[model samples]
Target: MFVWLTQFILFRLAFGMALLLSTDLLASKQLALNSQTADFPVVSYCVDPDWLPYEAIRNNQHVGMSFDYMTYIGVLAEINFSLIKTESWSETLDKLKNGECQVASMLNRSPEREKYLLFTRPFFVGANVLVSNVDQPFLQGYENIGEQVLGTVANYRQAEYIKNYYPNIKLKLVDTELAGLKSLASGDIDLFVGSLLSINAQIQKSGFSNLRIAGIAEPQDILGMGVANGDQVLLKKLDTAIAQLPEWVHVDIYKQWNNVRVIDEIDPRYIFGGIGVFICLIIIGIWWQLIIRRYNGKLVAKNSQLQALQNELVEKNRRLEFMSMRDPLTSMFNRHFMQDRVEQEKQVSLRTNVPLCLILIDIDYFKAVNDQHGHVVGDLVLQEIATIVCSTIRDMDVAARWGGEEFIVLCPNSNLDDAIKLANRLKDAVSGFDFNTVGHLTCSFGVAQHYAKESFVEWFDRADKALYTAKDTGRNTIIAAK
Candidate 1:
């Protein structure tokens, strides 16, 4: 029995040793396969040659957020990137289209780009802002941009979006963001749209204190790397690398580039002077106490005067607040005030499951009137139209001067059909009303109801399209969006 047991133990030991050796061989084979798979060919990449804080080609070297992200991703994926120089973003896009470059370091994905490139998942997201001269009033939104000559970078996603949605806005395309900003600073363009980071960086670098952010624009910048559509393998590798990236790495890179510090140092002389002033105040307080009884009547009169000044100051502030939310000529709500009201009403409509609608009105041939009758007469015409619109709509509805020769109405608890009816009434009122010197004028209207879960921009876009259709078909008409 002892000899039989010893033979069984020996058999078990041999079997275990063979299984361990097989497992080791399989692991070694997998390691070799992985190493071979990581050996990818060098990639040629292009960047916006002038965009800073995001990506740029400076002195023939690639630098900025894109560079840092690609460096880490390349190390992880075992790929190499070679810089392909270009003079401008437009040129960079041209090179990518013609296959001169295999990748774009950072750009927003667009339908036109999808024809030739495959985009990786977005790695960086930032807001887009409207920039204008310091003297310009705060813009309500892009939908109210009117006929201003807006500047945008050539080949930028924003340029395409504005062209497709807000066709009324006159776009002046520049080669780069820097060029566009410079143009804006020089008053060559009314406004410029760009990513917040790049805009801030350029403004600081160039000391463009004359320019200020007017307002936030629709559609934030969602940026990702783009690879040539033909290179599926490279695209897959890049996607995997981006997915494997740590969240901390993103925060770190953003901080490294965007961190702004303001250091305020106090001079010792100022500190000493402040101390001396405090001491003098204490001595003065003691002296004043001795004279307090003698000056009681004077103090009472002085306090009365101060109180009257405070009352006047309060009244002025109230008037200022009212003026801020109103168009001076029309005495109606301005676009800035209406934007906030629309957001609030939208939220209420969503929460209560009630209906919300918007109507856009444009004065037909209004510019002709301005040219023929001059701006003073044109102002009177606008004021009259505003009054007619106010009288035509219900008190629950909100109206605002959308921009030059344009206005918007927001209706709560109203459906498309009801909104269309309201717009018709407004159109008829404006058509029948007579401007004293300008004679009779007509208006075009576009009406749209908010769809469930749709964004403000989408709703506004539908209405804007309808308004354009009304103009195209003929003036003095109302059209409802489907």
Candidate 2:
């Protein structure tokens, strides 16, 4: 019974091509034995007119790989089918399912639509690939794509696939594939994920030389055509027609659409750059050997002096960079950086009418800890405490070491109550954390909400006063400013 039920479902899911084969066309050998049983020979098919290489109407003429294949099938079956063009893929699918259109060309098959339609044996197999602007360097692959923002068609399989695994990649879903392509060309997105064939064709038509393929997506089931689910007779007919097609049909289709060349790997600049660097290294090595062989005491001393100066310069640059907006020892944003960030947050909150809150945290009995543990251990504790605070804050929230043992957290769009609750959570998280060799630690925090007329510094002073109150009244507690 299970086998019979499966067979019944499979048959109903296929096309109605069997009805066409059994007509008078079959008596004349024009139609196959598995052709559809329809009379009067009325056939209707749906195609996405804007999709290139696969299906598109250009200059009042419809020509595409799928269109040609369907035409070949029509000629063999002696069926006169009316071509129905739709602007969107979803609309075309709707036409097919509603019986307004009997065939849909070039659709991917997946579980989402399996219950509603039958898929043909795949006519062509291709991959979704990354496309980038011509001036930009090609991405290494999806693995190295975190820094880039990608654009793609909404509801396309590539977008869904990326969202499933590459959650860190920034994705902007456009209305259509062409919109995604245009966004890539306009620099709206660093990369666009689309079909290799279709994107290449669109690029050629638009005369876009700067756009190129970055990488290809893994082929999967989401790429195929859809037919009404109850069309078992049609499925057998289409399957028979597909099996009988010339082996060269696939090759011909590919050749007809092969205009865009996909770059399967990285650009030559890096490759050439690496070779140049290696040659330089070899030359330097030979020079170093010669200098060693002809060693003069004075020149050797000069070389050592020059090396020391170069090291000093490098160290100076490193220190300068480290000190820019950061406390070097704790690796937290310095007071200057915190002030600028808070000012920006205040302006944004004023303009958008959004709530903003600030939390001032101080290490409880920090001076006592320094006296007992030595300044070196106190420095370690500060570093450990900074790490704890940074880890506990949300990505959108900003945490900075305001100065010395005090740190500030800027929470945007958070109200007074939410800020108080979050302050308590952070206090708890810090208290519960085991700081390894540092042993038990606690912090006192002052939380304050922003008022519309208050300046960034004004709001911070309120939070700061609360911190002093927490320290005075007793440590290890959170106080909210009135």
Candidate 1 colliding pairs, count: 0
Question: What's the residue-level lDDT of 115 in candidate 1?
Answer: 82
lDDT tens digits by residue: candidate 2, 41-157? 656777777777777767645567777677556545545556776767678767876788876766765445455677655556554567777644545457877787889776566
Residues forming the 10-long window of minimal summed lDDT in candidate 2: 31-40
Question: How many clashes (backbone atoms < 3 Å, residues ≥3 apart in a chain or on different chains) does model 2 have?
Answer: 25
Prediction RMSDs, each to the true structure: 21.2, 22.3
lDDT of 1 by residue, 193-272 (tens): 98777877776556565676777776667688988846867877887778666666687778777743222355698778
TM-score of each: 0.48, 0.44
Query: How does residue 348 of candidate 2 score in lDDT?
Result: 50
Candidate 2 residue 253 Cα shift, in angstroms, is 2.7
Write out the backbone clash pairs for model 1. none
* Each candidate's clash count: 0, 25
